[model samples]
Target: MVKEYYDPEVKYMLWDDFQIRHIDDLKLKVKGYSDDECKEFDTTEDILQFYPNFKDFIEQFFAEEELVNSSTRLNYLSNYADTKTYSVVATEQLTGRLHVNENLFKPSPKVMEVLHNATYEDVYLYDLTREDELAVEISKREEISTDHILIHSGSSDVIKTVMSLVLNKGDTVLISAPSWNYYKSIVELKMAKAEYYDVVPGKNSYEFDVSGLMSKARAVSPRIIIITTPHNPTGAVISASDLETIIKENPSSLVIVDEAYLGFSEQKFDVRHLLAAYSNVVFSRTFSKLYGLAGIRVGYGLCAPMAKQVFRLDVNPFRVNNISRKMAVAALRDEKYYKGLLKDITESRNFFINEMNSISGVKAFDSAANFVFIHFSENTDVQALKDYLAQNGYLVRLWTEGSRLAMRVTLDRKETMEKVVALMKEFLEK
Candidate 1:
């Protein structure tokens, strides 16, 4: 039997401190776990063998870790509530990710049938420039020119590719406060600065600060400005006229309008038309949202002809997979299926907002997208409320901008949402 270097009973206790990012203390604790009686290995799997309980820790904690420069590091958000169980609702998901009960619609049966008939060999395509087939289809739907479209895996991939192709070192990028955090991290990864404009909460909904955005554009002269329609977390949108004005105001800068949730918005703007009118306008659309093809992972964008050339240079021949390509085409073609899902989501969103607002100290904003933005009164203990929700088997995306404690809660199916609202009411009272 191997002699243990550390007390076996207390070994697991170290994980608690490690989780809160006490790296120095964690390093000290790890040395004790190393046994001089056994051979040492540097590989993660081998290290896990010596520390058996570290399996899940390694898998979850370090998967998306980013080492920023020399001094800073990035850590992923924790999913404190267990996601596997039905009672532990995953309201944290911001995408149009459907629950099992929400599968009222699906991709066309013909797509699956065709896929079955299709051979694996036929899936590979030599065309690195996916410009003609799917791009043309997207152009037709978005009312943009074929030369302006590029098909990619998803919005995240598209954003990375665009950043790589467009930004230079020390250049600035502008995004809204409380927008997608990934955008800021990616901008930093490219060695560009990220500046944020504020999104002020209004009487019934959140409003974008178009003037503040313009002011920042003039002050920083950002290389790119990312404006998400039916914006993430807040569900606020910049109107078509406002978006065009911003583009016109910042003629030298590239303005990217992310329309990932546009299909679910109450007011859908045709920002694709700006592609033809402006040299620096880029509009991204994803099948992840209204199409309910989040798993398929297909997203495309409309940009200037010059931007397309840069994208071609940056991207490989087979950027998007065969299954994603075909499935996206099928999903896009099936308008009826998406329309049904949209109706269901819209109804649920409204119901959720109304129900949440009815609770004392809770202010649920009307949402244009699938998730609703909510805030608690000053008297309410926001962190305590979140803990209560998690303990009661409901998980939500909680965000803070200054003094505000907001929750971006996903609107599940009507039945599920009704139960969640009831819990919220009870929790608020408590």
Candidate 2:
């Protein structure tokens, strides 16, 4: 006797590498699903693709040689301990008590004075009821059509809210293949189906199966379309020409562009340029990858004015939390830190690609994001390669199939890069 709506839990985007697979985000329970930690860290204690704990791999590589000294180990542990204070989860919990002498909650003075003088009613305990002040601030900052940046507990909350606002049930969604592999999971839960397209892999490497996508878009009654840039699993960006074509053709479908890794790109292409051109485009961005805000869960979606009505109707209140928003605000202001990381990523990405190109059995995939993908020679010993290299003190990503050697390496410092390359060269030689 009750009407059932699309569940957003099934709509959350997924990352296949270095996440907890079997367990829920609260990290409590496990379902009977089969996949290594490659899909998620809640997954098995397999290898870490991102911040890989490669110390064991290091020790084994030089087992016949001298071990890292106790003093050195202590120094490394000391650095790790020092890092505890800066963790996003820890900071979020400790934020309210944090010293505001530094002006943490201080919005632009012009912005703050207005809030200070305004009549405050309870909307998430932040001037939410102020007739026009908070409304204008959020509208300008978030591009919300009416008012309020939706408060969300996590990516799942955002996804579910979007679904309720837009589709009724069984509206077709189009996605590309060889993605993070969780689009199917989200769709299955909402009774939505995705027609997947393919990306042609090779040099002049910025190509997607646009015709395949267009055909599917027309054939199915597609209500939504999603694509990623600095693409996951593959780091290629959608070319400008192709993007224009896609936008022009998909008039009826509300296109969702997940620019999760846009921060990792060398050139910045604001989806705003496209969103301004087409009212049908929706831009989703996350603080997960480059911001190191993944665990604390801060993500935002930019939609055209018409779409915000549905989004506002669908989202929950104070889901973001005072601390997470503060941290997000902190990260945005701390462009200095991001700039330093960006430099490291650019250098590391180039090194990784050059190294991959040098390897005889490997074909490196073009990537503009933080990680790199590789296709290995047909006859290469994939598992043995991973195991042998593990003993040699480096752990690269191992794909499920045979004859493919691929790893998505994160950027650290210059010294770390030298060590990674040296170890990789040693393993490949053996």
Candidate 3:
């Protein structure tokens, strides 16, 4: 090689030889060959002669890489990796437990029947009419036109699609402090900026700082504003009058109202008036919370005609499959069952709040939604209490902001709520 490494007529042959030798070494390593055995291989063909199965592995590996990396977006996006060992252990310990913090419960028997009776065509076919069918059902329920409704896989998908369509680099999105985390992630993904408005602690529960939000909106003139009614963790709701005021003031900005938890609230307001009044408003809802179909991922939005036209361009025609559509429709039709469930949830929520407030060091806030937010005093052993709850087949969401500690427990069956409250009482007595 030192004497004739760069012959002009044999240059191509030399390059080919080098590549084959390197590939043979890689194959040997992949086959768990020792360095001594690898030294015996001079070419890919020679390695294949020793281990025939090695060729299939190398070919499949390269094919998978070629397929995955073919997308241009992958070059800039971060690659996902498995969780660390300790994180995995913690997750395993909490698996299959009562996840009260999710605000989830079993679906109606009618909805379960539809799922169980799914036909072969329902699963195998393309379901071209599923989205339109669901839209019609939603339109009838929401009192909006089918043309103004757009069905999506979930409310999160609605957010992602709308953000992708509207946001540009450096655009501003106004969000409330301690809003849904998905909003923050989606804003960052679109390379946009997020501006915050505070939700302060009121006399009863957390509430939106309307004047503060309006003041900021006037200053930033954000491209989009997200308002989550019966907002998560705190269960604060924005009044319809206040909502209209915000929309009227921010005439140019697109306003998104997230009503995912609205079904559980005692005070119900029709959003059709706002939708008819403003072309810049969109109300997004999901079948996850009250309907108990979170796993199926069915969500829809009521948009103004102008907004609907823009959204349809990017939304997939077949994004929601046949089975999901059927289940959502079934859930919507069985309103009586849901109403009964809501009554139970409301009762359980009131009981939990009243009981938790009776505890000396704990303060449970009034919630319009199906979950209660309980704040622990500074001296209380919050971590020990959480561990005690976890040990007794219950898992809740713990919220920490600076030195403040709170637990957000979803309203479960009356019996389960009674048991959890008793456990908390036992823990605090020590």
Candidate 4:
């Protein structure tokens, strides 16, 4: 009798009694599985029954295949929309695309005032002083010296510059699975080998599998390790103590912490002590999320003096424009405005998680950031629900893992959250 098995690692579907042992030359190497080695399924539905997480993606794959092979393809060809074009159309109609969590709130009025009052020097002349001025403001805020702060166009530029500076061909880089994903891409771009540690789902939120990370770090002795706090998509954070433990364990490796969502998280920890103790740590922060200064594209990194010196060699002295630097400085000084925004975000996030959890067959995880991660039970028609939400002018980020169909929804205004919850219930009832 023939049986089917799915490889979650490489997302391959295997037929017959063979299991994939490895890959070579773009082909899977298979060996017959022992009775105890693999789970067997007679049909795709049976596979779904046993592995709930694969249900959504597997079903969608099959559906798409059927659509392509059937008469529907020919009939629709004249007016067909490819996935990319369809996405563009859908995005154009969205009330707001919550997938990215771009701040709907405006930046501090001071930022606008500075931009409005900008002179020709701010636009045409070389940025000589503003970057230094912004660094001084950040140094005061972070309680770090100006020499240790590296200002860039955005945190992403920092990551890229660091990778370019540090990564040699075939150097091993360790990062968490289900992380920013861009980390993996950049590592590969540098011709470096990327190794992943796990980030497992927990009762209330996703958590770092720290022990697993340490194990991988020991085995690979990776040159760089990247950690994200108030982690993207999952909204989980690594405690400062745990972070220190990781840093202490791998003394030789450069540990980079992406704290782009810093102000949104409720958990507070100081990195000043860590910076004082370790020279191998880099903490990246951005004005994009909390300050609503994404349009300005200003970000900075706190690094040790030694690391800063090496990074400076590759960084442009005038990377940030004069206008952007001044605007970022303005955002920094308006603490009261940001505090009020943080309060509203916290309330909206709480309301969203609570309401989502109240729905049958749905689980909304607690988050430390401006978004919530939601999981739908196997029985839920997630694709249908996603379509319904999109039709109603809402858009969210969606993906699937073993036995789970999940989405990350950005917290918007309270009224928008209420409408979303109501629409979800309306879809479920139908």
Best-performing candidate as measured by lDDT: 4
lDDT (C-alpha) at residue 326 in model 1: 67
* Residue 121, candidate 3: C-alpha displacement in angstroms: 1.6
lDDT of 1 by residue, 1-430 (tens): 9666765544454233223334444333222122244333424545676688888886566454423232453224233111121122324333333222223244456557546776665476554553556777787877767788878877767787898778987999999987876786677666678898988888898999999999988999999999988888888877878988998889999888888877776677665667667898887778777766767778887788888888877676665776667677777787876777788888888888888878878889877777888888876666555545554455556676664566777767788788778877876775
TM-score of each: 0.75, 0.64, 0.77, 0.78
Looking at candidate 2, the ten consecutive residues that score lowest on lDDT are: 84-93
Q: With candidate 2 superimposed using the best TM-score fit, by how many Å does residue 39's alpha carbon deviate from the native?
A: 17
| Candidate 4, lDDT over the whole model | 0.79
- lDDT score of model 3? 0.77
Lowest lDDT 10-residue stretch of candidate 4: 81-90
Per-residue C-alpha lDDT of model 2 across residues 350-395, encoded as one tens digit per residue? 7767876787877766677766666666655555555444333334
Expressed as tens digits, the lDDT of each residue in 131-236 for candidate 4 is 3889999989878888889998899888878887989878999988777767876776667888989888898889999999999999999999999888887889
| Per-residue error (Å), model 2, residue 115 | 23
Which residue pairs come into collision in candidate 3? none
Q: Model 1 residue 274 lDDT?
A: 74
lDDT (C-alpha, whole model) for all candidates: 0.71, 0.57, 0.77, 0.79
Superior by TM-score: candidate 3 or candidate 4: 4
